[model samples]
Target: MTAPQRARSAQPALDRVDRRILDHLADHGRSSIADLAEAVSISASSAQRRLRRLESEEVVRGYRAVLDPIAVDRGLVVHLAVTLVDHTTNTVGRFERHVLDLAGLVSCHHVTGDVDYLMRVDVADVEALDVLLRRTLARLPGVARLTTMVATSAVVDRVTQV
Candidate 1:
């Protein structure tokens, strides 16, 4: 974990006020303590106290600016469904370790079902995708097969809403 990231405590029961604070912060990440207090109908000091508690408890991880993929030259998004040769701990560990070296990796999930892992990758175009598939993904340890799906469009996600 990074310096500001703490290991989360056992799921803390959230009250209505906490939920409201989180819901407000989800859409307005840059809200100041005063703004957050006003939005949540709490005192600034209470907002500060609660926000600090949330951060220390790891419920509020950290703030980051969400960037547009096209603005960053990564206009194409591809889903890679990866099937490993086996489910041995060693095989899974090695495969996951290798995936960390891959560039343009937006997210990776080790999931159940036919595929062992699903990775979301962003690239400039098909040629870049081809390079990633042939040069990087194929060479990952214990990778038995890969299925690719190119996304035509992205749907908006409301991730942190209560």
Candidate 2:
């Protein structure tokens, strides 16, 4: 996973201590407050306060445990470029709602140019992928066309740095 990225434009500027705290947490979300304080050369209470502020400001959204897809029988990763038959607001809304909870979907991005949405799907194998595409994805509302590609390798997967 990449490091936690710097706060967005609307957020207040992060000082050196805040950056250190974020950097440490990005690498080790499971670390205790004492550990974080020690790493950032601050007190435990200070670390807690800073973390609270970050969370309240929506800077630190949440923490998650990263899992290995292969270990979980979801090794196959496919990218789909989907084009919608129409761009009506209602159609797009329905389409978005439909894909939001798909079982194997990892990410969905509303994109510009040739495609309406780009999706990352993970499954056990090509056979499973075929079933998903043929039975479900291809039949999704507003879907007019789709181009699929399987990923052979991943070169980088990191959290953005502070």
Candidate 1 lDDT at 54 equals 92
lDDT of each: 0.87, 0.87
- Enumerate residue pairs that collide in model 1: none
lDDT of residue 56 for candidate 1:
90
Query: Ten consecutive residues with minimal summed lDDT in candidate 1?
Result: 153-162
RMSD of each: 4.8, 5.7
Candidate 2 TM-score versus the reference = 0.83
Residue-level lDDT of model 1, residues 61-154, one tens digit each, is: 9987767666776778889999999999999999999898688888999999999999988898999998998998998999999999998865
Tell me how far the alpha carbon of residue 39 in candidate 2 is from the true structure, in angstroms, after superposition. 2.7
Encode model 2's per-residue lDDT on 1-162: one tens digit a residue: 223444344667689999999999888998999999999999999999999999898779999777777777678888899999999998899899999988788889999998999999888899989998999998899899999999887766442121
lDDT, model 2? 0.87
Query: How far is 18's C-alpha from truth in model 1 (Å)?
Result: 0.9
